[model samples]
Target: MRSLPLATAALTAAAVFVPSLPAYAAPAVQITKVYYDSPGKDLRSNTSLNGEYVTIYNATTRAIDLEGWTVKDKTGYTYTIEGVILGAKKKLTIRSGQGSDGTSTVYWGRRAYVWNNDEDVAYVRNARGKLIDSCGYDSTRYDYKNC
Candidate 1:
């Protein structure tokens, strides 16, 4: 009983002197995967080009409204995304060719290949042109083979 008040006061003083941790922001949308190389007999065909895609992921547990996002390749090919709601922990794949929008996939409607077989970089930006995420590739090296 004699030491209860002294212990409480000491703990309170230590807590007051200790610094609090900084607050961290939620994770933004990111390019989790990139399928730059299309595997088929005809690389230029609509079917083959449509197979090349990039996948964006929302890792958080809240819906994100991607109203005016843009995905651009290293060769200046830009795909503008319209009104789309990305659900929590969900992924959206944007193909290089034409197709109707689905629950987890969308189309870029490109006639030619947007990504190169040797090397390339894919960038994802928000409506304000701020980079959300990006992925790169290098086919020439043995260790860097994401092309």
Candidate 2:
């Protein structure tokens, strides 16, 4: 009988042990809230739409750069987050319509309403196109899903 080579024997042993070890997944930074429909006398106006927003929370210990990230509605409206750093355990809110960006809130700069008052979905994706989170809502019957 021929003896197994040193590299072959070591690789076989390593493979057997490695497969049993659990792989670690990265901690999830989640979408904590979505104020998709802003209540007011007027829903079509920019001011009313501006009140519509989505909030993301960083549940990790380190600061995260959200630049190039996108928050988009089921419709064509998409808000690109730029030059924003979410601190550890911090929350960032992205609102619809035009406004100056601030520490806790940012604007999407759309003149019209992005979220449908009756039903809509919001999606968040990182720079690498990885889906960070998503939420859906149906305001007519007050049904909110995947929040």
Candidate 3:
């Protein structure tokens, strides 16, 4: 009977403290900004398309390997991240048009724009397709949203 009471106390203590331990409870990365509408005319040029981009920020203190991760819009237009390691507390801009990939920038290589000008949602997923973070905007008055 004494052993049973002691075991119950230990289990109760574990349950009470386990969830309060210091841990990373939020996503390491998030969509920080989105430039849905490019400046000037919507001429559909590569440079113009590149002007419209989404910027993601790493919120962790450690570098995160983003290979095979994905960023998708509401209509299923997705960009699979490849060979990019996000540094701690940094931002990466994913461009819509074709370009060389750099440490802080990547190109989606899409000929057409992906995000809707009226309203849309951007979902970031991990390599295993688990949702990490999401941001949405519904405004034609502004060309960008600080998500």
Candidate 4:
């Protein structure tokens, strides 16, 4: 019988490649920790433009709706993150405040002082594009106890 049609075509190609694989889940936003602040605390400022800040930590467990979620700065300058809401483990501070014409308001470090103040690369996207978290550093790499 031709090996029963090659074992029914190898079980229909392993059930269509095992459900198309790649279904890990678990990663709503787990950056643990990351740092680069200079608003004034003096945590050994390496310099990230002035009043720079980018701290995100939500080691999962639930609660995460950072609106559209976006923060880029290699020069492209994205920074969307509206409304905000990151409970779970908790910890979110994407800065560049002082708006209202007082100056110092571009959002998400506003390019962190034009780059190279050490280095920069913090992209966290999740509207659908994926990439729930990313953390590249500079300006002495500030802090990241559990990243």
Candidate 5:
């Protein structure tokens, strides 16, 4: 029987191992932009519900169901979004008032509760406790800031 050459054996081994490379996985979600309609020195003191809002942009290619996701305030209370499915590359706006048309514009059912025009953080997480995106803002400065 003829013995295989060293180079030929190495090539065969490499071919077998290369195909087992890990597959690419898609990210859950991400915050592409953040903004508020109201531009005041004290966001915490803002009373007009319509003036304060938070906009989240979906940066993934797949549609994400935001039913269980939440937007936490500085006080650790979460504002849960119901019946919301943000499409790929689409934007969802959460204001201090009622719900929006779910297109480019979105409304917040309870805006006043989450409106804290100071330094606040927005955390986006899935149902499985996985954090998707996070953004912080200083209400004293930009009314809106992109994450």
Candidate 6:
């Protein structure tokens, strides 16, 4: 009984002395959304394919240059980001089909689809190959996933 009381007192003292940890900070760049399944059938049309996309958002307060960044899927389908600077607190939508690059959108220019309908993972990496964020979906019920 004496040993149990001593241990309890020690634990209580330690708990009182320990400082609370800070909350976790959000990622600078995050894969916020993934439009995995395009509308209608998987006909692989430009419009249909354009519907499939991944939205990468910058969560930081400063603009992030994604010149050399890369966006990839589970099966290694990668889209190398070139000549782009994502604005602070803004979203960059990377579509699967071909399109002209814009301030908020870019094209992967792939003839075939990248995201798997049933299940897939989207990964975003920095210019130096550091992974910034990723989002995944395993269900076909929902066509999109808000990451």
- CA lDDT, candidate 4, residue 35: 45
Q: Write the number of the candidate with greater lDDT, choosing between 1 and 3.
A: 3
Residue 33 C-alpha lDDT in model 5:
49
The total number of steric clashes, by the backbone 3 Å criterion, in model 5 comes to 4
Return the lDDT, model 2, position 132. 81
- On lDDT, the candidate that comes out on top is 6
List, residue by residue over 94-134, the lDDT tens digit for candidate 4.
Answer: 55533322121224434334323466666677777578776
Error of 4 at 38 (Å): 8.9
List candidate 5 segments past 4 Å from native: 1-28, 36-47, 99-101, 111-113, 139-144
Residue runs of model 2 more than 4 Å from their true location after superposition: 1-27, 141-146
Q: Against the unseen true structure, what C-alpha lDDT does each candidate score?
A: 0.84, 0.80, 0.91, 0.58, 0.66, 0.92
Q: In candidate 3, where is summed lDDT lowest over 10 consecutive residues?
A: 18-27
* Candidates sorted by TM-score, best first: 6, 3, 1, 2, 5, 4
Candidate 5 yields a Cα-based lDDT of: 0.66
* Tens-place lDDT digits, model 6, residues 17-45: 97889998879999999988889999989
> Each candidate's root-mean-square deviation in Å?
5.9, 7.0, 6.6, 12.1, 6.2, 2.8
Judged by lDDT relative to the true structure, which candidate is superior, 3 or 4? 3
Say what the RMSD of model 3 is: 6.6
| Distance from true location, Cα of 85 in model 1, Å | 0.5
Residue 89 in candidate 1, Cα distance off native in Å: 0.3
> Scored by Cα lDDT, where does model 4 land?
0.58
**Candidate 2: clashing pairs of residues:** none
* lDDT, candidate 2, at 30: 75
Stronger candidate by TM-score (2 vs 3): 3
TM-score of each candidate?
Answer: 0.77, 0.75, 0.80, 0.29, 0.62, 0.87
